[model samples]
Target chain A: MKLELGKLTIRDIRFSEESKISEGILYVSKEDLRRVALTEEKIKSADFDIARPGESVRITPVKDVVEPRVKTEGPGGIFPGFIAGVDTVGSGKTLALKGMAVVTTGPIVNFQEGVIDMSGPGADYTPFSKLLNLCVICEPVDNCEKHQYESALRMAGLKIASFVAGLGKDIAPEETETFETPDLLTGMKAFPELPRVAYVQMLQSQGLLHDTYVYGVDAKKILPTVLYPTESMDGAILSGNCVSACDKNPTYIHENNPIVEDLFKQHGKTINFVAHVITNENVFLADKERSSNQTAKLCKMLGLDAVIISEEGFGNPDTDLIMNCKKIEAEGIKTVIVTDEYAGRDGKSQSLADADKAADALVTAGNANQLVRLPKLDKVIGTMDYISKIAGSSDKALQSDGSIEVEIQVITGATSEVGFHTLSAR
Target chain B: MKELTILTNNPSLKESLTQKYPYLRCGIEYRDVNFLKLLELVRDEVHKGARILTHPLDGSVKPMETPYKSILVEKSDPGLDLNSLDLIENAIMSCRKFHFDERELQPRVIKDFQIIDRTLMESAIDTSGLY
Candidate 1:
């Protein structure tokens, strides 16, 4: 499978009478976008706002962030399962509106939601602060169930992102990049001298709020499976879980996964980049055992020499991570696992709930427990009612001076397990 | 039908699960305890040969961050399951590492935590096919 990813850099974004991408500036029609968001009756109101790179604005209780993209010439659309038919994607041309994101925020679904400060100390930890964010604040109808509200909010973000991306369908891209993944036999033959490498990605599928979807199906229901790496780039996977804001892979990260990008850069040079194996992190011990066994089996069957594994949330998933590492290493396959640490505020605690001697080659995505102080910003895009209740925040989070002191966990993408940000330890 | 038992500190979950399923078929053990205490209870049950059906740790919320926890386990027996014992012991240790103080949380926030706990258990029950 091959995909031509066309990128159109968005220098600026503002509300205008019509929606279009003109001369690297994205002009959005607020009413039109709101209409798209309100397509679901469960969303009582939809409001739009814009936060730039250096603005004194904050977006709180953020649900998901999605990059605007349109499949200009492909067998399937941008988001295959939800917005488009479940046709096989990752072939043909797709245009992405770079330098901008559609950030969805609303009433806190759970305590796991995050915060994104556009400027000041908090902005340094989160990558979203640097993007031109079109904030979508949607309120659910009264008496709406928590799951129903979460679904409504998740769909609203995707719908608005798709609508915004449609404006770039006819525009010529400023840059274009191509990614190709050959069949297993051809790939093996093409890179006979290089070491065969694969990536094992763990999807959060603990339960209702902690879930991921592939081709519109709850990932928990599916067994370990393999996919062409380009499939994820074309929206074969999506983030629907409300995990910790920092380490959670939002829809935007799934669309522009740093691991996939880096791996592709090394493809055909230092490594073979064989395939992407996806597994779930379930709540049941039996499910964990079965999934990890299947994952290791797949890696061994692929004839892989080495594989890079990345996990979503911590704790419960740490057990899954260790299980996969131990099982795969037992097959004589070298493994490097990527994950974040909850090493206590002082950084003097166990990094993971479960560990094994086999997981020696590991990459850490910083510590989510490290505390930081976020100075008050002038403007707020979303309600701060839940700031004190969010993960990594305390009841004393709100101060008389209007500043907040919280763990980096409250900041979105602060310690992305996929290496989405630039934070590293000495 | 497989014998299933639910141990939870969330009163709402206990009431809902008990009302939905027959008492004899699905056992609901409701205990008034904090998050760590609830895990201790599950550990005690596991020592008596109860097998854990669901993960003791919730994926999203930290241990001390939420006051409620719901764990599903098989009926007690005379023989112990080493896997269950290992998992429960690890979960207890993991909970102690996080030092979040949830005592000062507002009522609305506590209610939100309860809902999250209940929903996760509901998902487990949905896949359990016990209904």
Candidate 2:
């Protein structure tokens, strides 16, 4: 499959009477976006705000961040499962509004939400701080359940993002790039001499607030399956998981996955980028064993020489990572696993909950327990009431001077296991 | 399906499981213990030949971050399942790695933890087909 991605560089975002992209600036009608968000009855109120790069703004208790994208000339639309019909996507032309994101925030549904500082020491840790963010703050109706609120907020963000991205459908793009992945037989025939490689993406599917969806199906219910590399670019997989902010793959990261992009760069040149394998991190031991067994079997069936496995979240998922690594290596296939560490504040603890000698080739995305101090900003887009209770934060997180001290885990994308951010250790 | 028992420290989880699966009310065990003690209870059950159906450290909320945890296990008295032993032992070891401070959390936040724990256990039960 081949996909042509057209990029519309958004230099500025402002509230205007109409929503459109002109002269590299995105003019959004706040009322229109709010209307889109309020379509869910579970959401009692919806408000819009903007935070730009170098602004003294902070967004806290963030649920998800999504880049605006639309299919210009494709078989299906972006976000195949949720925003669009359950059609197979990943071919033809798609337009993406670059340099901006739609960030969702609300009352803390769970403690696994995150924070994004637009301009401060904390801003440097999260990539979302650099983007022109259109913040969607939604409030749940009275007596709304937590799961109901999460679902409403999640759909609201995706709907608003899709609504904003529709403006770029007819506009010309500033840049265009094409990505193509051949079928297994064709790839092997064309690049028989190059090393055959594939990527194993582990989706977080614990339950409730922690889940990922592929084509609208809960990932935990699905077995190990193969996807066209280009399909993910067109939004086949999306994050509904509210794990730790540091390592969770928000929808934005899924739309712009660094691992997929980097592997594409080395495709046809150094390796025969064979396929993309997706498996889930379930809570049941039997499910874990079944999924990992199927994953290794799929890798062996694909005749892959090497595989790059990326984990989402941590703890019990670490067991799945090790199981995949050990089983795949047992098949004589070289495997490289990517993960982050929770080595404690002193950096003296075990990095993972589970470890194996076969996981020798590993890439660490820093430690989530590394402490940092975030100075108070001039304006706050989301409530700070939950800051001290978020993951990696403590009771004494908020300082008397209005600043906050916390582990980098409180910052979104700080230690992404997929190499989304620039943090790495020697 | 085999006889499955759910061990949880969260009161909300125990109530929900019993309410949802009324027939399995006899198997749901609710203990008034902290997160670590709940895992110790599961470990003790594992030593008595109970197989861990779900992972002890299931959620990504960290070991000590959330005060509630629910684990599902097969109630069969088969010989010791080494996999269950290793998993529970590792979970206990992982729990000790983190520093647990008794901070007063908001009532709403505590309720949120209970709901999350219940949801995770429900997922395991859904897949386990204990009904």
For each candidate, give its TM-score against the true structure.
0.97, 0.98
Off by over 4 Å in 1: B1-3, B19-25
Worst 10 residues of 2 chain A by lDDT: A417-426
lDDT of 2 by residue, A267-290 (tens): 999998988999999988889999
Distance from true location, Cα of A287 in model 1, Å: 0.9
How do the residues A219-307 of candidate 1 rate in per-residue lDDT, one tens digit apiece?
98889999889888888899887878999999999999888888999999999999989999887777889999999999999999999
lDDT of 2 by residue, B18-72 (tens): 7888765337788999999999999998888899888899567888689898888
Clash pairs for candidate 2 = none
lDDT for position A145 in model 1: 81
Interface Cα RMSD per model, in Å?
Answer: 1.5, 1.1
Per-prediction DockQ comes to: 0.66, 0.76
In model 2, which runs have C-alpha deviations exceeding 4 angstroms? B1-3
- Give candidate 2's chain B TM-score: 0.89
Lowest summed lDDT across 10 adjacent residues in model 1 chain B is found at B17-26
